[model samples]
Target: MSAEIFDICVIGGGINGCGIARDAVGRGYSVCLAEMNDLASGTSSWSTKLIHGGLRYLEHYEFRLVREALRERELLWANAPHIIRPLRFVLPHHAGLRPAWMLRLGLFLYDHLGGRKLLPPARSLDLHQDPAGKPLKADYVRAFEYSDCWVDDARLVVLNARDAADRGAAIHTRTAVTAARRDGDCWRITLQEKDTGRESEIAARLLVNAGGPWADRVLSLSDQEGGEGEEGHRIRLVQGSHIVVPRLFAHDRCYIFQNTDGRIVFAIPYEGDFTLIGTTDRDYEGDPGDAAITPEETAYLCAAVNDYFRTPVTADQIVWSYAGVRPLYDDGASAAQEATRDYVLRRDGGDGGTPALVNIFGGKLTTYRRLGEAVLDHVEDVLGARGPAWTRRAALPGGDFPVTGFDDLVARLSADHPYLVPTHARRLARLYGTAAWDLLEGGEAALGQHFGADLYAAELRHLVAREWAATGEDVLWRRTKLGLRLSEAEQNAVADAVAELRAALPNRP
Candidate 1:
């Protein structure tokens, strides 16, 4: 056990865990976070990659969740403009499902429910005349267009962890929390290093179980006397999967297709070359890590888009697909699609000299900041308040520039690095914002070995040194989606380069 104690120790390195660590540590709390894998390697990275209000959730009457998420869209965009941006979604009217009048009413509420400002309001579209209607079936004559935000989900999680670490929090990647025991006024945490089989211990006044899909399993590891499994806060393991294919449309706007089964699917422009589609929600079992897109899911997604698009999508067209298990707080909703997306926070102990435990369940990417603030409320209740809620207005690392200034940043980056092509500069500016300059330091010669697809040794070094990226998978997939564009030989070279870099660089904690 460490002689020094931390104020809080966070388990899991997903968006929720990283967001809580950032918020708590920013509020003067001494924090330590442990992730069993690379940051955002789990559920966080496998999202449909949108920071939206969940328009379909309105039918479930999740008004509060919708409003909260809707309000957060622009705030989060401003905080991380490099990875998040506004996306207009077109919902074409089907003949039998959701009448046009009802759609208008729902959209009106969606526009007014949250204090939407920077994002444009919902508007009706004449599909016959609008460019958005070009690829859609002729059956759809009218549609509704609404605003949501697209996000680089993995980067968002990493940026939060980066900001937290920059603010003095200890972030431990590839470290698993083996056990947590309440020891009087504090908790003793056992951590096992995955690589070297080394075991160590630390003490914290409070422990936060932000384990997304493994919340129940995490509770099983806790020495809680007489506490029911998960302490009555059972989570429903819901698997949501997405697929990537060659770009289906030429325009920038996304499509939200309504399925006959009452679920919804989104087809958005991704990586400038492919179209991103998916998100099938179904009750999941077994290990969340083992979750993958079933054939039925793939077909369902293809058909979902096929129903709306003039041309059909097929299985062979899919280039990449991923699945994630959402650990939703099970509210006994019969269908997986009907499960509540609202977050629930449950606290234990922290009274009369007892250590505290806060378990977080059921949250989405759009509401991670608010979820962190709520978690801190429980933290403050246990440890007393250290700082006021400050994340709403704060800019995440590399996101200090204006949200609308992305073009200017790209132009400046292109001008500064004459060696960089316009597309490469734009890509860097989109991924790193103002921080691209830091990555491009020492000019063109500094980029070192070219690993294809504009990936370079200097970028890999920066990821290892600053972003806690240990493997090429972390670099290619999470840090940047270069994996989609890089060929097999190029990927193998990147893996080798990352391994060599990790061996040479000082270890990060």
Candidate 2:
């Protein structure tokens, strides 16, 4: 085992930790981040994939959270135009449910709550005549349309981690922080790779517990006692599950449906061939890593959307389903849905003599960047080693192109490689942006062997080399959504290909 030292050691590679690592490394901090699993193998990748102010949060009276998330939405969209693009959602007004007046007011606040730039404002819609309403029931005569952005959630996390690595942060994926303890003024931590079962030790001036769903479990690793005795760790494990069905509508717009049960569901166009419906907020017990969608939850989601759409959806038709455990801050909320979406950073051991530990509890994808900024604020106060904050204006990895330049980028990509079809070129540009050229610079001939779908050997090589993608699941699921498109045999081929490439590599992270 190799022994080394660092200024900051972050334990988790989700969006929040990666975001923090990116900010820290850019600010010239010697940093190391370890993830027990693949990056975004938790709640970060399993989001509804919207970068928006939670409209429902308005009912919770969380004004501050909504505003911050709304503001961060634009910043995130601006920072990553390739994977994050503006999406418009249509909320059809049901006669008996929340009155039209309430919906209008909510839309008003949602629009003005955050500064308006880039995205268009919310507007009233005549569902009777509007194209977005074509798929809804006949009785829903009016609707409201608002703007949010769609993110390839898993890719977003990977991009942040990639940028952090680019800035010189040692990122250890599939490595678990087995134990941690305070050694005088530093934190001595033990890490074990999941596959190899090899243990290594390192010391860091600061430790960060960014375990999303397992914050409490992570805290136990350090065996540190806190003042909130009996209260225990503040994380409320809430499992949100989503089901994807065959394309429900042909429109580009998304639908946000309100249920009589005071809950809401989003039916969004997914992956060009399916409709994604989601998210029941039920209090979950047991290991979050084992969280999966239950039959009842699937029925609930299907029924939630069935109340609005003209074509009814059934459970058996689901192409894919995913459930993620939300590590919400338990603020004595009456229900799991009512729990706070905002993040809380509880700092310990930073007063004077002891080393500092920052434990992050509860955050949403929309506000991850700001959450990271806040984490750095705590780090600066404790470590006294500092640099200026600079993530807001930075374009992550290959996202340097203009926000509206997607079509142009696609055109350029196809032109660069004339052999690439329209579908292949567009997928490449969206996933890799200008970075696609790195793999395709040799044109179709240099793209190596085709592994079916839009995936090629060269692209797989790039993921392995730069993105820390090791297993087939890493490439098919997180790094790209090709799992949905590739067949069982093709998936196995991808796994075999990745294994071949990974084994050939001399250095293993």
Which residue pairs collide in model 2, if any? none
| Model 1: pairs clashing at backbone N, Cα or C within 3 Å | none
lDDT of 1 by residue, 144-228 (tens): 9999999999999999999999999999999999999988788999999888889999999999999999887788789753236
TM-scores vs. true structure, each candidate: 0.98, 0.98
Off by over 4 Å in 1: 225-231
Best by lDDT: 1
Error of 2 at 109 (Å): 0.9
When summed lDDT is taken over every stretch of 10 residues in candidate 2, the lowest stretch is: 223-232
RMSD of 1: 1.3
Against the hidden true structure, what lDDT does model 2 obtain? 0.90
TM-score, structure 1 vs. true: 0.98
lDDT, candidate 2, 1-509, per-residue tens: 24667889999999999999999999888899999999999999888999999999999999999999998898888889999999999998988999999999999999999996989999999988899888888988999999999999999999999999888999999899999999898899999998889899999989999999888888888857643755556888999999998999988999999888888999999888999998899999999889999999998998888888888999889989999999999899998888999998888888776899999999999999999999999888888757899999899888999888999999988887889889888998999888888867676677887888878999988898888898899999889888999999999999999989988884753
